[model samples]
Target: MSKPAKRKVILGMMAASLALTIGLNPQQADAAVDINASASILVDADSGKILFADNIDDQLPIASMTKMMSEYLILEAIDQGKISWDDEVSISDPVRTLSLQTELSNVPLRQDYSYTVKNLYQSMAIYSANASTIALAEHVAGSEADFVQMMNDKAGELGLESYNFVNSSGLNNSDLAGSHPEGTDANAENELSAKSVAQLAFHLINDYPEVLDTASIPELEFQAGEDETIQMQNWNWMIPGVNAGHEYEGADGLKTGFTSAAGNSFTGTALRDDMRLITVVMGAETRDDRFDETEKLLDYGFDNFHEAELLPEGYKPDGEDVIPVTGGKEKEVSISTSSALRSVIKNDEEELYVPEVSLASELLNEDGEFVAPLEEGQEVGQVQLTYEGEEDVEYLYDNQSSSTPLVADQAVEKASWFTMSMRGIGSFFSGIWTSVSDTVTGWF
Candidate 1:
């Protein structure tokens, strides 16, 4: 062929390859459902998949929902052995003063009164009690100042950039003019986006499931001393209503909060069968608006979205025949998946494209002898697939990766007599005599 003809042929092949690559990528689908909240989000708690989001990244005041961080930090303390449910907490003058003067939600703690950490946690989770929150923060960090720092640190670790913390309690501290007046610092505004709050709630429920148990209780009464026991009802109404029904049965406990500045806000979770979902709503006009919006979001999620397994469990890439070395009994080796393979899929009409499995070249040497001591299920290579028909795909069409052994597999026999003899002699010199006897006596 002429040089000009050859160049044209090469260009055509390159263009064909590029087109094929583009054809296989996965494309994002449009939002199939609409929600009523100003800012709302629904996510699969297990896969971190965003099933639906509306202005989810917009930052908004979370009101007493800030207690979620308080809950997480406290649980982390319990996990780290810093505090326990049985630990006793005493209400200091600061706690008492905050409890008495603040019109904010509180557990009505009295001066010098002691309560268990468990009760304090219940107060914060169920009632969004600012006083109990401050007390718990002080107990965990020795001071509210330190606790706020810890909260900010955790937010950073969780990649929450829209959030900032000024106090253990979520009270707007800036308006007080009295001697012990509350004030909000510029940093204390403690803003977070709906998506970020949803992320935080997911982590809390997924990691510490006990939180739902405490938060879901509709009513509880406790006392500080000779004073009458106060009845505390869960502010999140969904727990007693729709969530209590079989349709919303997986509904777990979460928090609700409202302030003039923060408006109505809620973070809720529900698990239906194997599917777990987290919904966050913020910036509602009325106290009940947050819960209503959250319910709508969760309803849309459970009604429309479903957990679908894309790949069969235990599906794996097959390994090519590997050559055995020297005197090994087996001449070739192969590998397979040690466990099931699977992926979460949407219930929508869009189907998950089948994955393509690819393996590396067969293991062999220049002499054509098989490599001995081949490990079973060793990741010889990868498998990948591209969607058959898709446009404007963001991610690659095919997923390709290496395989790994579910369990450890090693060679029990040596490949060559020379290699086995060397190992035997080394073992004998090292005071391991059995292997040496076997190797030497085997020659006979």
Candidate 2:
């Protein structure tokens, strides 16, 4: 058979296996087109599952969207109690120097000017103020160089495998801008993929939900203590949908960026009841195109897909049993899969099948007891789930199949046998020895 024919045959066999395992009614699966800028992605924020992706892994300059990491680390500092929103940050000479450069955005900050940390965050998130970013970085890390290090460190912690940062402000090249004449060294560009940006956006909203309040404000004017008030407008056009004269309900706050090299880029988020989705569009031809593409992607995600709760609450897998442990306080301990177990269901005519659960092997024990010092939520054994279509055959002679393993949630604990046996043996040996010695020496 030809390659296409062979693929179809294999798919059929795999579908059959899936149907038997998950008890799913056989249904057809359809593919969807990914629409966006050069590289785009839409994903379920809570699950980190990719709903749609176009050139997701390709790394590119993210432009002002790089501020997201800056904002994240700053907020994280606040959350850790290291910095407070009300804390006053003095504008240092370095910050003053950067603000003086006209090529970059600034709030006309002066040396010795003091602004609340909260206001700086507002400036960064609301207006994408480059000066505010530098001030906050300097305040937080003592220098922009140290703050960029923190940004890279946070990216690593987030598992952003294809991301890097060289500056808190997403300056393309300092040499080209000639912003810092004395410090005219060309700064390396910050990089991130569309998928990773989506993930980072999700982390911001999901983990530190309070940031949304600042980012979502439609407009705010910044006053620097008797200095001229600067009118700040939100960069995220989706908020209230005023950019294109179209209203998008449930549109929340996010960031947008543009640079000669990075092109027009955006990371937008929307919510429809319980289902929250994030969309990232990078490297668009024009500013308007980026907004239009992002709006379209958001619409597609909201209209075509929905959150399907696959496993009901408190639903445990079948055939789940107690796993034995050695050298612990208990002989065997029980574990159950705790995942909510859900998937994104497409709004198509074909019936969607359920995923089947499987186990890798039974639990094992060394000698009479299990391994010691088992912590809660530890995986003692493996379980897998296979997703497939339902088979048509009704009788036993029909073809059946298996699928790739989905890991089972396993919990481990101390085994009681080891604990009890050791205690008993120690007591018995001590008692006998003590009695014999006492009898021989008559020193009870």
Candidate 3:
């Protein structure tokens, strides 16, 4: 693009501060929820802002959903050069044995043989294969115990509110053939809050979107041409025509879990009409109930919420639109939001949001004056929306922050030496005249 065109595009962004107008037009605190799970939540995938929540903080068993964390660490290992998708991984006896289990296993394993990390990861994500999950975890961290430690540490790092990782596979230790992670009890299983699981799913897709490529696959063969190959089906039926002929529109990925104690759970995400939503269902009574509840959340979100550009480009806060410019040719520089502020909000809640601005302290002095030589679009600080009404608001990621850079709308060049000298002289005389007038007033 040409320079002018680029500038025009850049200038089209507006940093807006959200100031919730309370009582005047209160938003429905619980408009989009009518779920029957022990814990459930719906969030805007991009903003991490909750649209509906119920018992979201209740910690519950996650079952194979526990693989979500292992998925994250495995993906991280690949990203950090610690491992590669094609690297061969060792298969322990316990993994091989568990893969042979009658009820909870998929994609049979042969410990004497070898499998690539990609092969195991695909099986883990698409099939929620217990043995494949353990294999990837072991490959990434050398042991399921150590991998469990990594899972808990990463949960803490991700600001998960309620989480406990006993193993990488999210299976009960009793199912591990007495070979569960070192420190966990024989009956222990992975657990997380609905919010926490949503948080994990949030980072999983945001950090390694490629996981969806496999997670979305309806079915695949673990060993395409090998005799020991097993056909795997993704438990996440939300994927289009993935299972039971049930599908949700825009459904692409996420994770699913089931265990007697954990019941049924799903971390499902979908995208449609430029608005993506993530839903979590925990402790559901039936496998199909989880998907039904997820569909309920997705339907409400898509039907009620929209991506609203609340602040238009060139929008400036009511009283915080200009920055004092010291040493610049102009006394003050006009500023605007660096980008248009958009949020997934319910249709009736737009009037409740207002824009506010804040500046970087280092860039400005106590009197709110910035030094000269600022380029157009030079970022200064940020604008954030604050809600004071009854509804609770939170971002899924712990470190998720308000965006839209507060910037200088126009360039400001330093004043010439001649201009500086003249201004200094004028100030000197003006100060003397003020002092003389004060003295005369006191005498009178």
Candidate 4:
């Protein structure tokens, strides 16, 4: 056979061996999901799995979805001791002015009224109150303008690419005092892609889960038990059983938004059967359409996708390959994965998973064997577990796919020639003695 043909045969046999050893088989993979919204995405909040997405990267006016970041920064302030939930925040003029704007949502902040930071949080999170969000922004960062800078800075820190905040409230009013004033067109609005929104939501829920306690409130009187109280309602109607207009089961607290330029947008989260999903919908035609489309997005995720713990943190991979030492005390050292690997997988597609093992090709000498003077826990290689699909019949969510490091399982020191020669001489002498004893016993 030609050399190329012989190599092909060898490679085919190795692939077959890997499949049988890993219990993988040829099978269909996950199907793509289509959503009705202009831009949308559904992700596993814990694993950051993109179960479904439609134009998720197209930056559009995300309306009140911008509040997710506002809320995140406010919550972060509370966590870092820069502010306290119990601390009273004096309402600022910009916030008071926002209260008078009938076109925007407001919790009716009064400049003279002293409200607890907690009250402001509830109003902003549950009601999507523009005034309360700005009030909290001003109180936390000295001015609303400065607060917008913090929001943008935080977005950069989170590695978000498609977000620009002209205002903390997600309002698209050119009249507002900000650098990126609301434009006559969509570009002027606070913009982000559905994918970026999902990531922001992911950071929000993961870093400060306590914010959910505020977001999930169906209804609360702002400053309840105070002498003067304002009725506040969660604008997110998809709050499970809380909002009668659309009570999605497993739904929880999030924010909603709509503007003449941005249309309707929502960032929602839900949990069912130990799995939490984050959904983002932008530019839905109507108020109800946002909730309806989000419901469909969430349903598609919970139905089609399933979470599977592929490998626990600190899990060692099976059949860890040994690294041969060139000149070491030990001839070889074993290697394994240094971290855990988990994912949200498609149901019934477990058989199609291909765990591709690889080592740093440079670690191999011309003999195609690992040359080692290796230390324990040294990083040597990597193993990536993926599903087969159109990109090879893949079923695994891209974000949640496992890429684990292969580390040295044991230390291998360089072997010395003197030690090798001594061992060989000892073995030869021992064999000679054994043979001499056997012959003497036979003669006797």
Best by lDDT: 3
The global Cα lDDT (0 to 1) of model 2 is 0.70
Give per-residue CA lDDT, model 2, range 1-444, as digits (tens). Answer: 999999999999998897675554322222234354789877766666565667888889998899989889898999899899999988866666766554666666765566899988898898888878878988889777788888878887877758877788787755224433123247667789887788689788888988788888988888855756888778777787346553468878688888878899989888886888888999999877787787777777777778765554334556554545555555565555545455555555124444444433333443433365655655543333344433331111112221222322343444467667887899899999998998989963
Taken over the whole model, the C-alpha lDDT of each candidate is 0.67, 0.70, 0.84, 0.76
How do the predictions measure up, each by TM-score?
0.71, 0.71, 0.87, 0.77
Question: Which has the greatest TM-score?
Answer: 3
Cα error, residue 413 of model 2, in Å, equals 11
Error of 4 at 61 (Å): 0.5
Error of 3 at 240 (Å): 0.8
Residue runs of model 1 more than 4 Å from their true location after superposition: 1-32, 175-187, 241-248, 318-333, 348-350, 356-444
- Candidate 1 lDDT at 328 equals 57
The Cα RMSD of model 2 versus the native structure comes to 11.7
Ranking by lDDT: 3, 4, 2, 1
Candidate 3 ranges with C-alpha deviation above 4 Å: 1-32, 386-390, 397-403, 413-421, 434-444
In model 1, the Cα lDDT at residue 54 comes to: 69
Cα lDDT tens digits for candidate 4, 1-444: 999999999999999887674454322122224455688777788877666666777888888889989889988888899999899988766667767674677767776667898888888888788878777888888876788788889998987868888778888756454423223233466888777888888889999998888788888877533365777778889875466878988888687888876788888999988889988888888888888888887777788778776665555657656656665687677777787766677676666666777788887788756775778888888888767753233211344445678888888776678987887899899999999999999998
Candidate 3 residue lDDT tens string, 394-433: 6776556445777899999999999999999999999999
- On TM-score, who's better, 1 or 3? 3
Error of model 4, residue 65, in angstroms: 0.6
- Residue-level error in angstroms, candidate 3, position 407: 0.8
